[model samples]
Target: MAGGVLGVGIGIVAAAAAAAAGVGAERLVRARQTAIDLGVEDDFVDIPDHEAAVISDAVPLHVEIDDPSPGSPTRQPTVVLSHGYTQHHGVWHYQRKALRDAGFRVVLWDHRGHGQSEIGDPASYTIEQLGRDLHEVIGQIVPKGPLILIGHSMGGMAIMALAEQFPEVVSERVVGAGFICTSSGALSTVDFGLGKQIGAAVHRLGPGTVSRLSTRQKLVDTALRAGRDVEDFLVHRYSFGSDVPMAVVRYTADMIFQTPMSVISAFMPTLLAHERTDGLAAFDGIETLVMHGQQDRIVPRKHADDMVARMPHSEYIVVEASGHMLPLEHPEIVNTEVVALAERSCRAVDSGKRRARGVPRNVTDLRAGGRSRRTTKRAAAK
Candidate 1:
């Protein structure tokens, strides 16, 4: 009788798995159909003169540049966007379009081991290395410019690491920054929506287990393929808040699914060990925005609050009905904040110039002068 019961239980489990996979397949089909109906092909026109910034660790970071509008000012501040773990520069599609339309030059790049970039030494997957990669990308691409830096999730952590290691760059070039859905430290303590005991055990055992598992790439791939539907469901659950469109959810799931498991495993240890609350001090004088979702399960709202407490001057916002993927889930709010910060930074720069020249700080006069200069430059370019 016990043997019969066990067999029945196994059968039930198989049936549930089959049902989930069927649902997931349907969602995927609908998402692709929607994309086709929308004629989204032109949205991905290849960026002209795409460059690669090769880091010291032999990782080639794929870089793309979107120059400001033809009539925009020559000295317009450049906005550099960094994506999070298991994501590439393509994830910044909406933010990029908004920034570009608002007359800001934009820079986007894939982190080493993710996206189209070549995966270099797995041992070099620490946040510090990622910071160095950022530095190199800046030095090689936007060598000299007033800048606004934006990062999400692990990308936010990368910016903090950059501020920690290269404070001079932050002070000298960066005028503004945005940290969205990210934490400075204590990630291990967060529940991550996984069971408390299970989360703890994963945190403790994840690194070593991943290292061993990575050696068997075929086995890992096969296991992942078998569990694709379950993985998609978990990603959708943890990554978004209430009422996200199914197409958007599927799009995000596709990005996550495309990332290699080895890359994910290699970065687990660095993410768990990340601690850089002190780095918040580096952006004290710079205009900064710290945003998070109220219902964020991965990083939590407290992390955003903690960052605000440290950098009191930084603007803090909590999206009411968003989750870990605030950039995609709440693009409009994020884009507005970023554009405002960019304008503020530009005004601050103008204010500093006036102060240095010992001229009276007249906001009206500065605005007129900037407009006149831009007009003159635009005519000359034509």
Candidate 2:
């Protein structure tokens, strides 16, 4: 009897798997048909550079430069900033100021369907498309020069995907990379908290009528009100380590709220299933930095630790008193390391030689009397 019971259980599991596969295939077909009806391509297609070069699609992309002052420092290396899921480029306002002061050009842009970027047909937005958009951005901005790319959360995944899918661009142009509060693979492992919950839901939904309905203004407003307390609860839990400024918190919350659910449904699954563990190979010969809040409840610090292990030469930082939003939560710390890395990378390129790189540094280490200890040691040796 026990053997028969086990067999029945296995059969049930198999049937469920088959049913899920059928549902997924049906969803894809329906989504494709919807795309055709809307006059959008179902597959990833390169968006042509328009006359004004305005980033236009069903989703709009916006770009901002902190310092466009010509002739200030033409050779200064540029740092491209990519914000995470449900966030716009505005989240980097604090870091942007510090970066400009550090004498480096900064490039920040909103992903399609977020911030000032156009949100045309939500059907066209996907992880693959975002990677292509970044490719285009690099082609236009960095061109033949080296670039330092910084990505937060979803943005980090997008950067990794871009490197994986377009190795040529990454090998030729990308000099240094920073992944803050992002996972390289298996995002649904529940270590990423909210990402796991949201990713699974969207994966099952597959971007169809349900996706469009979720993005409707009325539905979002109702959901926001219902989840207001929940929003504050999460903000306090995941957005910082200490008492963060209300403005910064509010700004982040607003950006997230503004992100349509359709966008989330379209790309969340791709991010979760995205396995770019091998993508770091492209940067093996270059500089990389992985920073995450040890206290981060969203994307666990272990993810960053694993990243450093993979890219052993890459700098690994664990911010002690920060959560997932390290860029905003600890802007000073992030700014210092990013600027210093940019300087080192730029000098190496300018000298027409790669220097023997030094020990991988961490923001938290520099903060906790590490710099003072180093200074004292040098003095004693002298």
Candidate 3:
């Protein structure tokens, strides 16, 4: 009996390793096909690129800018995208392409300690610090432009922080914003697919436990790699909703797997302690889109409802059968809403400009004034 049990355990581990390898190979093939289908080689290669190192909270953030399409008008509205915890700018690949194709300049950057950016002080890993980093990114990279801000998960928290910390910037430059798959408060109390008791225990012990676990970095990484199948299962369960393409699921899982445990440990405390419902006030009168997945286990749909209640004027979208990673699972829906928001923002901005310039609000009045000016010029010539 003992020998049989050992054989079964060995068989399971071998099967998992084989399955993981197959998934990795398949994902690579799919990625290549996707790039071909998306015309990335031609459409994406020549987009003008600008890199910046914006200093915020004594940390240098790695920022990248994709200029608007050729012949796009100067001073066009810029869309700035922020990714969630343990994610870098590449997670916004689909959104970036969609917005850039729409002739909007796109800015993407890694949060401090997440990607290529320097991991400043771990003590400064609060959401507020992320918000300040965003403010600095805007001021340095996109100064003097109409803005649309889009954030996912922790990125959404950062946007709220921006609104709370820099209301003046929000009112002056931001025309619209998208908050996707995030919560405003009570995050630690929520059921994260884990049982209530287990979830509660993690919430109570998360920060310190994670910190200690991170100390054995090499061992943890080895264990995680050995359990790739488990990682894939967990990521798919919590991060995605109905019938997500295998390629996307693998891509997202890869990103999560690549994230250093240190980053997770450093940010867990901030996420658990986060509470920013009051920050919704900063978005009052601003065009806001709040989106979440109905099946999201990480941040439940109730959080979305609460946010909508706070900002009654905001558009609320519930992606049915979706999980926490709405942007990846439902790119088309997310892209469409973002484009619509941008269009509405543009109209509002144009109207405000006309008003500021003292132009008549009525179309007939404007036409008459133009005719009168032309007639006066002709009479003067005569």
Q: Estimate each model's TM-score.
A: 0.78, 0.73, 0.78
Q: Where is the poorest 10-residue window by lDDT in model 1? A: 1-10
Provide the lDDT at 357 for model 3: 12
Model 1, position 349: C-alpha lDDT score: 80
Per-residue accuracy of model 3 over 65-99 as CA lDDT, tens digit each: 98766775543678899988877787677777777
TM value for model 2: 0.73
Candidate 1 positional error at 27, Å: 16
lDDT by residue (150-260, candidate 1, tens digit) is 998888888999999999999888888889888899876875544575455445555556556557668856865786554444555567664555556556666665666
Per model, state how many residue pairs clash: 0, 5, 0
List residue ranges in candidate 1 displaced over 4 A.
1-49, 70-75, 223-228, 353-382
| True lDDT of residue 38, candidate 2 | 27
Ranking by lDDT: 3, 1, 2
For TM-score, candidate 1 versus 3, the one ahead is 3
Instruction: Give the worst 10-residue stretch by lDDT in candidate 3.
Output: 1-10
